[model samples]
Target: MRTSRPWMTQAATRTTAVHIHHQTNDTTWRSYMTIRRAWPCLVFGAACLCPLPIQAQSYPERSIRMIVAFATGASHILAIALSEKLRESLGQGVVPDFRPGAGGNLASALAAKAPTDGYTLLLTSPTIAISPSLFKNLGYDTFRDFTPISLLATVPNVLVVHPSVPAKSLKELIALAKAHPHKLNFGSGGVGSGSQLGSELFKALAKIDIVHVPYKGASIALTAMLGGEVDMVVSTVPATIPFINSGRMRGLAVLAPERVASLPKVPTTAEAGMPQVVVITWYGMFTRAGVKPEIVERLNTEIVKALRMPDIRASFAKVGLDTAPTTSAEFARFLREETDKWARVIRDADIRVN
Candidate 1:
């Protein structure tokens, strides 16, 4: 209770100050250690919230898969040719899976639902564009579910007739058809096929009533014509070239932009006096929807480059397919326009497949 000596008091005060300083130091150190221990958790929580960016350079690091929706036909030819070119360009092999059934619907559905990682691609013809409107319960949407890469090639459908048909030219045939509506029956591979579409388009544009006789395939259709079962047949140039050369079937017009080399003597549909009767079975590439725009652009660039190579062109030309290269945007627009165009034709013609 008594007052302490001044020196001792001063020393006690100093001791208290030293004790408080030590407590403060200990509290601060504890707080710092708590933060240090929790720093990893905070960082880990942040990382879990945000994913790191993937390097785009490592893209296409594996073999790409191409889905072709046809049998061993023009679509197959296009897929093989394009795959060969892509192998040369991408340093990776393109394995083609031909899922040919349901009017190529099976393949299109699978391709539409495939992963949008630039690995699984679809190489199909205008059938992709035509099927949407041609069939009512088609599972996949063409433009919505697909990312158009490029328009690969275009093959003309040569309109041919059995020698029994007296019509020598398209004008003669149209006049004959108009003279005898529904009397002139045209053969096609199947309903909603390229041949059928072409034949239907001709019927509508020429305002003729040509009945459609669908067969199992173009060859079969042409065979029917040879047997005199059908009056005329709309078939691929390659399929009907031999028949035309043998003088069994007569070529009236080529439904293409210009005269095909295989049938140079045959006038184009436009040249035949119907400018809107171009029926090209075009082949194009598409990927699954929701693909990154940059990835699509890259794919389009590579594919267009592949199509331009002379080797690719010559190989395709051998089969009467002209390698048609177009930008992604252009191809998309073309798809849309063709869809609308074919839809109109299908509706007007009342063409449908169950």
Candidate 2:
């Protein structure tokens, strides 16, 4: 929104000053005209390039505080992972504050009241976007109270089964579940979690009946799978990738539009002949609204750079997270679209939380 940059103005002033002085000296004037004729206006790569603003130079004068919506869920893990890379890029420690409760409302409420100095931020999942639709009284307006910085990554929920299960693919799993009725058990992190919603969407699309088993967290749900307490678990790639890769758990399908690069052999639900079965669990970063536009752009630039690093990309890919960095404006648009989409799903499913 800011078109006039102070640095660009300063650069243009210097260019004018030099040209004015050259007008008085015949030799200098000839040199300036020759250079100008060769380079033209826009192509003039003179010392007239704009530098970064002074305010951006001093950003994060101290440690940046990142607030997480979940105490020990994927949001916290993602914040920790990105913090390491962010600290390396910004030269300041990016601290994570876990304020988990109220179905992610507590963190958003606190972040809304935090200073708009770019120090305090929120790292959240679809819960924040889904709050308005799921709850009767959401404390903070997601679109109004926050400035979306970047979409950190898109983590697909995989339909994973213990090796003992007979189903080898998503279609096979559906057929088997249909025949077995309520005999099959599907695990989730908890009620209303991405894992749960993804599993529910699968049931509605595939028309299979599998009892839902809610665990305290994703780690425990995964543990239940390893112990044979649950037949299948539709969890994030981060929690299921290692087990799936090691042959301990078989990946039936990914709940994304396309096959994941990390799990190349696994087909997407759409590729498995069920294009309606799509569930995306994502991670995103947001600063309090009303922060300076320049600082917001600077944060996006550095964060995007960090995500582009080879080591960072590998670490995220290893867990089945696709690096999806975007401009602040683009992220804002995405947030609105996701909020609208989840609203319809929650309303149609009659999802409710106390």
Candidate 3:
């Protein structure tokens, strides 16, 4: 050790302490910097390694439930055909589940509360619009409770009389009803049913006093007609076309703007001099409200495509249905118009159901 001046000795001691403190500070700072730089990368790596539950780009991952509020057969044959086609388009099993009752008001109420997902849908007729005015106090608001995905098509009703009724044509039926007054009875599926409205329209237009006999369903009404328990029926062409051809019933006039392809020889209500007697029972698809617009659009597109398929078109034609699909907005507009038109008819005719 070398001897030094007092100030130099003090300075050396202080410099050693400063150098140690500086080294400690530098080490701590380096450690902190290393941790800070590695933390973000570590977090990013972990995020990339973990699985996230993201929604699929496409929808309808599971089987879809279609609520059918009516019976099967020619009555629902076209709807069934369309459902099968929709299944193919959606890459999912679209099943029809029937729960028919209350003029389809029951199924409508159930569908209104179903999940907003596209999995649940309603395959029903235009009775949806009429029900609002038909029923005094229904559980759901027809227009607000559901979303109309697409208008499938309209099935024109035909005025048909039982062979025993003695009415050869629409003209003869009007004359007979006018002569017979309240004694000329007509049967319908039920009070406020599409058939009932069709009959009412005919009565209103022809200015006749015909009694309406309500049955449980269209089949029942047709059976009553065949058994001579009822005088006549204004039902769908498909429902009564075979009977008409078999001579059990006589096709008077079609309740369409034009004659149906299946019944070309038959005249339209318009051509029969009763243009206001038109009543078409339309069928379509509706989804639960709050469904995403994208899903609704997808469903509408698939339905329109399904309706246009040649086989589907032929199926509807065979059943005397006009197979056409309308957009959501268009369907909404049609529903409003139909509701208004029928409201006037119902009010004017004093139509009521028990």
Which of the two, 1 or 2, has more lDDT? 1
Residue 158's C-alpha lDDT in candidate 1?
79
lDDT of each: 0.74, 0.72, 0.71
- Residue pairs whose backbone atoms clash in candidate 3: none
Q: TM-scores of the models, in the given order?
A: 0.81, 0.74, 0.77
For model 2 the local lDDT of residue 104 reads 79
Best of the candidates, lDDT: 1
Separately for all candidates shown, the number of backbone clashes (residues 3 or more apart, or on different chains) is 0, 0, 0
**Residue-level lDDT tens digits of model 2 in 1-354:** 110000000011111321211001233324433532453242223214754578977887889999998877557657888888789878999998999887678999899999899999898877888777776667788888999998787766778999999999988988999999999988877767667777776776566788989898777988999999999988776677789989999999876655666678888776788654556777788999999987887787777777767887777665556666666775776677667655655554556665
- In angstroms, give how far residue 196 of model 2 lies from its true place: 0.8
List the lowest-lDDT window of 10 residues for candidate 1.
3-12
lDDT by residue (1-354, candidate 1, tens digit) is 110000000011112321211011223324434543464455446446754335334556889999998868678887887787778777789999999988788999899778878889998877788888877777899978998988777766778988999999999999999998889899888887778877877776677788888888777888899999999888778788888999999999987545766677888776887655666667889998888776676677678777767888777777766666766776786687677667767776777786
What stretches of model 3 exceed 4 Å from their correct place?
Answer: 1-57, 74-80, 164-166
Ranking by TM-score: 1, 3, 2
Each prediction's RMSD over C-alphas, in Å, is 28.8, 16.1, 30.1
Give the CA lDDT, 0 to 100, for residue 149 in model 3: 85
